[model samples]
Target: MDTAGFTNLLTRPGPYATVLADVSQDSDNAAHAKELRVRAACEELSAQGAPPDVVAEVSDRLAANVRLPAPAARVVVATPEGVAYDQVAVAEVPNQVATWDPLPDLGSWIAARDSSVSFVLVLVDHAGGEISLWDSGLPRPTSTTTVEGDELEHVQKVQDDVGWAAYRMQQTTDNVWRHNADKVAEEVTRLVRDHGHDLVLVGGDPHSVSRLRDVLADQPVEVVELESGQRAADGGEEALHDAIRSALMDRVVRQRTALVRRLEEAWGRGDRAATGVRDVADAFVTGRVETLLIDPDALAGRTLDPADHPGLTFGEAPVSGPVEAGEALVAAAVLTDAQVCVLPASVLGDAPVAALLRWA
Candidate 1:
């Protein structure tokens, strides 16, 4: 996940109040449930010595998403100024955390965002396609568009004749199909490029799928040709939705695996790698980290004194006290434009944090 989103929280002064909680609007009493959750979070922040103004701001911000259904959890970080960083997280928060700390508890927020995937789903046929940009765990697409190709007769195969004249007719039909596919591919590419889409799912007509894959072969994003689905209304059929979700999850797994493999290879060479709290923190502070792999549980309760790292890039305010090590490291990573990937507990053995640095 890109840590740049934390610029607001990092640039402002803290004792920041970070709240991670369930904000799902699926139930009939969703408004009340959400209010209750917001109330609880606010009360906790108050108990943690957060200012009333900050607590009120956090409450209002958390409750503002009552109408957005599933991807039930949200993470909000607020300084006394107002809400700073707010984003919808993965489907659930098994354990909600509310804290007022020297630095925001960013590991939880990062973990939640890391669990989700963003991609473009193109349901195509020979004549056109429906393109929707989606994020896994969210109920509706962020954007939806339809790409229709030129109006041409006979955009499909016809085996009625075999003469030269017949071949000419078939060639025209093939051209129409390819032309339409190109139209859809162009739109898909634009959406992926503009949105920084992680994956592209192409489904529907097999020929159309093949053409789209061909056109998108050189793009940096991954293109997964789904085995099912067609152009339809807002949400595709249940089975199609399931297939897309599965593809997104599979991509997540593959990406995490690849990240771990890269770290392992770099570690084996004993270069471009930093492990344990102090080394990883130093790397982040110096802007040397390319990817910061954090095990939230491993780093829980750890602290980093600002005086120890005089050049910390978190905010303009001077050091007040020790900050949560995970939060401090993540803040530094964000300021330096590094990626943060949350690992499962203990995946890094006893090391609370590990990093693949830009240089040795």
Candidate 2:
């Protein structure tokens, strides 16, 4: 997910309705049941005063677009404008908790399934190989490409022409190998730029794996060579998944640790940081916040409009019910084109949220 994509989801004007559900079907009966359940759930939200138009739109869209999960999936739907559905298998999406709220509940689920970050899996051998763009929210590859080289083994083995035939065959093989490598490099680079993927895992034949990595070494994202992998449809995919998980997990850890250090530095500076909800909210209104770090656990604070300010306000009670603070800050961040990353409780210390400001 690029900044624009996430920004759209976060900043869409409310009242928003977000739902994550399992719509997997095993039989005709299961499929029918799932369909009815979806309609019923949408209707239930409508009954609870969700926008009639949005509900109608969601219903029609879900009816037309809903797909049975392979085994099971996490299907997320949002209102007004944005992605109506995002899903992946139980093994990939992991936890599935159905939810509907005025705000999109992607906070808890973004890193696990819906984040734009994805792994490019390349399994290459001498003859040919497969490259798959993998994202947790979708059960299969978003894009796939096959890398194949011209056959030269039999030509090399021919004895009639002696060394000459072997030499020519070797030349042709080299050409084919370079051509295939170039194709993989071009496609993978495009995916990294256009689709927001930032990591790649290459496995299979040792020579081929190293060559592919060298091809992508100039790309900014991580390009790792693994011990083994195959492009099988099932069962044989574990190696690739395991390698991807490990690499991405390392990235997540490094990112979180770096963010903590940055927060500490900003706080020490005093002027460029905001720790509590009130201060963070104020920072957002002033357009000072460049990055927001929030704990998904403490997202329920209410921040109401202050009389003097037009954009946003905090630390004031309202005569009427107030907007959820987390949602409000997210909206502000998106509107201001700032970044938001989930900061866990341990790293966040006592604050519900924090901001690293662009300026004092």
Candidate 3:
């Protein structure tokens, strides 16, 4: 997951209250349900010894935030000063998480962000295409725009009448299709370039889909076509979303496999890699970690002393005592501008934490 978004949080004072509440407003009494969840999270924070001001801030933010349409979650990290970070994710939190600790409990937020996919959804036909940008961890697309092709006198193929006229008409139709698909492809390329999306989900008329795919073949992104995904049909959006979810999961698996393979190869080489919490921590402090690999279960009960590592101090606040190892590692990785990959324990073996270093 990209840690760029949380870099500002690292520079803020801690003793943070982290809350992950299911804020889905799809229920009959959504307001009341949300209120209950917010209240419960605040209560958890208070029970965990969070300052009252911070707890109230969290509650207010969670309550006042825009409601999402489907199963969603809101992640809030606050300090006595105020709410430092608050964002809603598309997916729901399986269990509400509220933590009051020396460092923000970012595991839930990170997991959600990592699992949620961001891409461009393009539904194209002979005329044009509707392009929507699905932001990472957001329930809906940030923006939806349409790309319309040039007006053509005739876009249909001709039959029987033989020879020059038929051939000319057929060529015109093919050209029209290519032209429209090219317009969509150009817009898609521009969107991906501007937004940094690595995936483009295209679905619509089969010929249009083929033309767009052909045009986008040279671009550096995965183009997936869903035959069932179309524009404004009965239950089309729901079916499209389902297909997208499956594609995202498959992409995640592939990414994790590739990352693990790279880590293993680097480990075998005995260079440019660090394994176990201690080595990973040292690499993080030195800003040598390019990618931080974590097994979430390995973080249980583990602690790290900020006083022992000067590099761990990001904000002006002094180190009071030990902090959760998971939180500290994530914070350090973000501070150092390194990518964090939470992996399964089976892949990591005995290593609680591992990293592909910037250098040996």
The local distance difference test score of each candidate is 0.81, 0.64, 0.82
Per-residue lDDT for 245-302 in model 1, tens only?
7888888888889888888898889999898878887776677899999988778888
> Could you arrange the candidates by TM-score from highest to lowest?
1, 3, 2
Question: In candidate 3, which residue ranges exceed 4 Å CA deviation?
Answer: 28-36, 155-162, 232-239
Model 3 Cα lDDT, one tens digit per residue, 1-360: 889988888677677899988887776698789889889899999999998888888988888757566677789999888888988867767768899987778876776677767889999988889999986577668999998887666534446555767677778878888899999999999999999999998888899999999999999999998757876566377777788878777888898889989988997898998877777877877889998888766776788887777666655444568888888888888788899888876667577778888999
Model 2 alpha-carbon drift over 4 Å, by segment: 1-3, 6-14, 22-48, 51-116, 153-176, 231-235, 304-310, 313-321
How close to the true structure is residue 254 of candidate 1, measured as C-alpha lDDT?
A: 86
List the candidate 1 regions with Cα displacement exceeding 4 Å.
28-33, 154-165, 232-236
Which lDDT value does model 3 have at 355?
89
lDDT of 1 at 60: 80
lDDT score, candidate 2 = 0.64
Backbone clashes, candidate 2? 2
CA lDDT of 343 in candidate 2? 71
